[model samples]
Target: MNKELITDITKYQEFYPPNSLKAINNVLKWKNSEEELQGTIEALTFIVNQTLMKIIPEGRIVFCTMLERLDGRFVLLDEIQGVLNLNNNQMGKNIDELKNMG
Candidate 1:
């Protein structure tokens, strides 16, 4: 999925917090079959949940409800790959910060 697609979902901020909405939308824009969608959603949700769990000080950031409202799983995988493709140094630094926090 493209960042634009994720940003497109950000338009729905009325439905979810802007950051969570962007993350969910980033994953949902990808087209996938129902069975694949379910598993992909599960895995992607776990990745996002884990990342947040690593970085955040406390509380929870739920994705399943927002994901159910849209459509995706591999979309999450694709979005993550998209993140990996990013060249921004700050992204790596942020990840380092998370690792250090953990």
Candidate 2:
């Protein structure tokens, strides 16, 4: 499957109305293998970290907290290192730094 589609799906989540609660499946409608789903969330977390910072810094921090919780439970070692292989974009670098932390 194309990774860009996953990234696009993550961005599409932002278009949905602000709801009090939404299942992750609802947020990511496309079914993925467990690994693909986790990878998509990782991608979203990195992208959101940059955008949310500029738009809503407090929200960015809150989102990061949420990502931290998810990462604690599901993120993998190879996923972190794989981020380093992406283009030298800010989000990629941010993710790489996050990898360094663990």
How would you encode candidate 1's per-residue C-alpha lDDT over 1-102 as one tens digit per residue?
A: 222222222223332212233345458775555665567666767776666434321111112222433464445667544444444464545344444543
TM-score of each: 0.26, 0.27
For all candidates in order, the CA lDDT equals 0.41, 0.46
lDDT of 2 by residue, 1-102 (tens): 222212222332453322322367567676566676667666777775665334333233323533545845876657644443344365544544444554
Candidate 2 matches the true fold with a TM-score of 0.27
TM-score, prediction 1: 0.26
Error of 1 at 31 (Å): 4.7
Q: Which residue pairs collide, candidate 2?
A: none
Q: Ten-residue segment with the worst summed lDDT in candidate 1?
A: 56-65
Q: Top TM-score: which candidate number?
A: 2
Where is model 1 more than 4 Å wrong at Cα?
A: 1-31, 58-102
